[model samples]
Target: MTAELDTPILDNHLHLDPDHGRGIDAVEDFARAGGTHLLVVNKPSWMLEDVGDDEAVFRAVFETTIDAVERASEVLPGRAWPVLGVHPALISKLTGRGYTPPEARDIMQAGLDVAAEYVADGPALALKSGRPHYDVGDPIWEASNDVMKHAFELGAETGSAVQLHTESGQDFTEVAEWAEERGLPAKRVVKHYSEGRLDGPTASVLADRDELEIAAEEAEPFLMETDFIDDPDRPGAVLGPKTVPRRVEWMREEGYDDAIRTAHVETPAAVYGIDLEATL
Candidate 1:
């Protein structure tokens, strides 16, 4: 059964794939589990279909994400904000299409330029960008960093939060420096899929008991997420849609009410600059 939560319960990073996955059905699961809010991120372009040199093609991906979120808002008691951008994995796809690393990075940056317009136009509240989680050569790695920097710039320019999908086992010191230089606060730079090891950017730690406990103790001002890809083939690959509210219920049972408020209500509101309390 779902917990009767009074405060907001947010999943900071999630995707809703209508074509391949449960789509709005997943959002219903989250709401039934007592989740109140979501940061619905766009899936990688390649996941939807093969993309080429056209930067404007990303608009379809962003619009698809926004459509999912719009449908989700109809089912949710609280709210769902779309977070759009070029996924770092797109670099690999572009390079595979016979583009050099620098060319691929340019394409990714141009896509972020499109995404920034969405944020500026008030549909999206945050941008998503990060390097590949797996190992790559130095040149490709540098190109990815360049793309990340451009995203930070867009965040700063548009006054939007940025959720980064990155490799595991990082302190995010370099990312913090980049945000600082670009005028985006470290608090607004979220490290998605974090493992509670970061010291700078806001950690959107996975919704696991151990990860939450560690982030509570070590990472000040952290958030929680299921990172639910919503892909049917990989059911529960990262985590499921109901994981966040279930974990919040676990925290409530453990009497960590303050942590729940901070992670679910306060931190997200402050980072995304939204009145989440109003959603209730």
Candidate 2:
């Protein structure tokens, strides 16, 4: 079913790696369903075990995404933006498989360096760095925060927006403080897939229609995301990439036209500096 929305959507986060044959379908489907723009990211978690060589793993992840973005640019045009970075949970995932903290940090640095390259060029929209796995004991934060701080430093250096993935947005307060100390603009720091109280640039709660309304009322600068995982096997693991468009269609249906325009059009442009007018 093709969605014809009054306002086109810009999904803030989605993983569109190469092994993901489903990704092509997601791009086509999302566009067909009214997604005009996407921030395509690399999900290091999916390939962590398959590609045992840690350094090579990050390379493959970022390179595959850069290439995918290049290709999507042909079809989706300038709407396909790259989001390259190391997932904070990769360290813990590798450590569980017997890698030491230093070993993990070394591998993480390798991925982050690749991300820094694109960020410096300013083509890649943002660097995704955050605490994904939350069940670990308190001590794990020492190493995780170390990796996160480095990612944040890269953001500060490049002036690229840092889109964070957190346990439940609890770490963002501390992370935001960390970004401030390093001289990164608060307006360039974003919280990914979080609804908790965090002061920063953009925050996506993955809201439903009602929650979207509440979020709009609560914060003028808020955003929406699906966190789509483009995984072939799980089949809509978190939420489909087109979910945001569908939500926007409902917003239009419910006569929240003004709010829909703000979320799908205005906020994305103002927050990320992405000009969707070109896609039109």
Candidate 3:
């Protein structure tokens, strides 16, 4: 199953938000449209909305992520995978900004508990926070390390994959270095789109690293995204499964076979340790 024309390719990184019309059904439709596999992210917006504001909402968001993954596992079996994410900003939202204390510790511990449960489930747990604060380089960042390591440990225990998101290009390299320095057991580190870098530069950065994974989208091969926003007024409002194929062709034209090859979908099955061979 090489990534030839009409071959079933896995979309290694796809956002699955029900609010944005990207979820199991959208994934299935994508698969039917030629995508053989999809890694659906399970970070619900409610995870942010409920924090500090409403404990019930926060719990409900976490529950929704778990339930969504469970349902996806049952539905796709080997096709859909889920990547659970914990945003660092959530802590401030839950505990209030710069207001640390014994109670803050309690709140963080509670958050960690929820994080640990998701990690234990074997889905690819993604740390969606940025550098220094969340970078594995600083000692203060050790907290982030602890969170990632805990997730990695759980992945090691269950033979699942752990994915890390580096929002900055420099931090992306820092993450790869941190993984090497600490001997973290993560198999894949995903470099989310560096805010404003061009595709060529981003590809160059990713190409330099062997341990990191890059998620390529159809239009933006450097930035992996799948959810089609519902705003008809937007210029790219008609994006869909066709986007993947176009990106693949664009990369081919640019002689980016390596980048194209590294691209794979993040599916619930992959997160849960299903051993389906990579089809592309």
Tell me the TM-score of each prediction against the true structure: 0.97, 0.88, 0.58
Clashes of each: 0, 0, 16
Instruction: Kindly report the root-mean-square deviation of model 3 from the true structure over all alpha carbons.
Output: 7.3
C-alpha lDDT score of every prediction, in listed order: 0.88, 0.71, 0.43
The 10-residue segment with the lowest total lDDT in model 1: 48-57
Which parts of model 2 are misplaced by more than 4 Å?
1-6, 45-54, 169-171, 196-201
User: lDDT by residue for model 3 over 1-280, one digit each (tens)?
Assistant: 2124433355444554444444556555554444555555545343324453334544555555555555545544245555554554444443345544334334444554554565565453432322233423343344444555444444344444444543344435544544444444323344443332332222212221222233332323332344332222342333454355445555566665655544433232333333345433
A best-first ranking of the candidates according to their lDDT comes to: 1, 2, 3
lDDT of 1: 0.88
lDDT of 2: 0.71
Write down the lDDT that model 3 would get. Answer: 0.43
Error at 2, model 1, angstroms: 2.1
User: Total backbone clashes of model 3?
Assistant: 16
The residue pairs found clashing in candidate 2 are: none
Tens-place lDDT digits, model 1, residues 185-242: 9899999998865778988999889988887766378889988998889997679999
Q: Write the per-residue lDDT of candidate 2 for residues 1-280, one digit (tens) a residue.
A: 5446445677788877556557677787777777777888877744622433355666666777877877766666336888888777777777887888777776776678778888787668788877655777555666677777788788878877788777664335566778778877666777777662345546766756666777656645667778877667777757886788787777666767777667667777766677676565
Instruction: Give the clash total for candidate 2.
Output: 0
